[model samples]
Target: MTDHGHNHKHASHKTLTKADAEKALNLVLDSVISAIKSHHNINITGFGSFEIHHRKAREGRNPKTGAKMKIDAYNQPTFRAGRKMKEACN
Candidate 1:
């Protein structure tokens, strides 16, 4: 809801094209994914943090058949919003 002007540092706001915006977004997303793949946590001040959460294997039930199933353990990517972001949302 606010224009932070953080993305206009290199180019004028009016000069930003669709491709530029996509590229910038892709770069940020790629960086975050790469960090997570490397088992590293990313902390973006005033925004949030990205980390991996481990899920233990557990027994689950099949909805249709009412049968028991074994769920495999996995690592899940999680996000926790920073205080500033939460405040802004409210």
Candidate 2:
């Protein structure tokens, strides 16, 4: 199959290389992850917000043996789309 610039054209009429796009995406994702690790929330206007959600330890059932189990507490990263993004989707 032939590769293209995801059918997207830059304002300057230049198509971004796949590697470059991947690198850029990686950089952004890494930065967001680092911020979450630091307990900092990221809010990108017109894009979305990234934050961590904490869950307390709780009791759960084991599906395999139908036994009660203790679930450890953990922090989970979450994303909330901005107004602009939501509008764009609809």
Candidate 3:
């Protein structure tokens, strides 16, 4: 998952009550996760987009023992902010 460096407390200032806010947030998150799981791209205009990224199997290193290892290919979820979202942050 992408780490934007924000925490739950930071989002708790919304007008809705904590429970309602959490429920709404969870619903949205569940929908996004479901879409990604189905290999579908989700786009929320003016907010962002979510899609899957594929990585081929490759060699990797084990940091603890400095040993080489084979990393299996995988599909990773990725997000990209929309134009309006970027402008809002700046």
Candidate 4:
């Protein structure tokens, strides 16, 4: 396959079709997202961990009007690399 900025290669013996690949990706993402919604952490060995981070409500400003506003509290999804993943990058 031609490089498209990503250098990673699949090590699997079987080839994956575009539709199959997308479906698999969506399944994995949906599972992780659901875990986040339940305030659970999704950890993948040698890859990374995903979790929901809580953010407190805060004051913010509008760029156009320079008016003060309140930013509502929210939960955000975040990821942290595992030790092996970090080491591989270096």
Candidate 5:
């Protein structure tokens, strides 16, 4: 077998710090928030939407002892990927 010169691949990467990651995440959130404010909708092009969604309360079953439980409805933030994004994963 021949070496493909992959020896340096491991040394070339740097780990992102917590602060750096938080900043990056915040940047993405800021952009989305700005888009929502201006356009009333977020358009990630090939990626689906980031929007507000309302969930209705319903009854649910507990696995242990087979008991019925009440589930409260709440508004939730959600993402629905577009066709292109969905197709790419598959």
Candidate 6:
């Protein structure tokens, strides 16, 4: 493990082929994406919580035409780190 920059730690774990690692990553991310899409909140114990936040619609002006537009409200997922996970960075 070595420090690249901005306190980003890089560690060499079990050596795996690129294809194998990509497949595993995609599988894990897919599960997370699916869970976030369907559930309101997901708590990963020592990691953190991924919860959806609702954003209300607002009127905004277009840069090109300066025309007022109505924006549609939507839900966005946000992550909040837990104590154990937050301590790991330090």
Q: Would you list the C-alpha lDDT of every candidate in the order shown?
A: 0.85, 0.81, 0.83, 0.79, 0.69, 0.74
lDDT of 4: 0.79
lDDT of 4 at 8: 26
Using TM-score as the measure, name the better of candidate 3 and candidate 5: 3
TM-scores of the models, in the order given: 0.79, 0.77, 0.75, 0.72, 0.50, 0.64
Model 3 lDDT at residue 40: 99
Off by over 4 Å in 3: 1-16
Clashes of each: 0, 0, 0, 0, 0, 0
Clashing pairs in 5: none
Model 6 whole-model lDDT (C-alpha atoms)? 0.74
lDDT for position 67 in model 1: 100
**Model 5, span 1-90: residue lDDT tens:** 112222233223436554555566568779988765554567678888987667899999998867999999976666889999999989
Order of all candidates by lDDT, from best down to worst? Answer: 1, 3, 2, 4, 6, 5
lDDT (Cα, tens digit) per residue for candidate 2, span 5-80:
4323331255665566556666887999899999999999999999999999999999999999999999988999
- Best-fitting candidate, measured by TM-score? 1
lDDT of 1 by residue, 56-75 (tens): 99999999999999999999
lDDT of 3 at 15: 62
Q: Which is the leading candidate under lDDT?
A: 1
lDDT, candidate 1, at 65: 100
lDDT value, residue 55 of candidate 6: 92
Residue lDDT tens for model 3, 1-90: 222222244346656665665666678899999999999999999999999999999999999999999999999999999999999999
- Looking at model 5, residue 32 earns an lDDT score of 89
Model 2 spans > 4 angstroms off: 1-15
**Would you give me the overall lDDT of model 3?**
0.83
